[model samples]
Target: MRISPSDEFLADLERLLLDQGVAPDQARAAAVAVGVEWGGQSVYIRLRGPYLARAVAAAYDGANVGELATRFRISRAQVYKLLNKANEADRPQLEQARLPGT
Candidate 1:
């Protein structure tokens, strides 16, 4: 199936928020807010630190590192770092899923 750039971006953002422990409803709301805010801006608004890392990581799943780097305007190394951070965040969940009861 095909997805528009805007839809892909929003989906990536939502996933990033959700991975960071935001509730599904809140993630969608936050993604919408981000779109609205950025849509009205004439200049670029840079996202940094952990938030950017998470966003890049989430986007990586749907896109390659090169695409993510271009989309987020970062280097490949940075993308790897972000993806690594995201993986770290998922470690606990991964461990839980491996448990017998789970």
Candidate 2:
């Protein structure tokens, strides 16, 4: 299956919000809200998925790992694993977030 442009746009908006210094949870929630409004739950879930949750956690400024594990319904080990992968997957975003003005 292929991603539609709207799906891509929503994902981009999430990243943009994060890059612009919006809280990770807020950015993700905004994207999910827009996705649901424009498409539906299935579309939003399909596009965002567990990986996006992991990414949001990674970008999150001070998230507690245990709490994140509980919230995302994953084991702490899995959360650490996914966070590592997410950091690698979106290294540029991490870098951008670290920039002085961001």
Give the candidate number with the greatest TM-score. 1
TM-score of 1: 0.48
Query: What does candidate 1 score in Cα RMSD to the true structure?
Result: 10.3
- Which residues of candidate 2, in runs, are more than 4 Å off? 1-63, 92-102
- 38-97 per-residue lDDT for model 1 (tens digits): 754554546767889887876666559899888888899888888888899999999988
Itemize residue pairs with steric clashes in candidate 2: none
TM-score of each: 0.48, 0.37
CA lDDT scores, all candidates in order: 0.83, 0.76
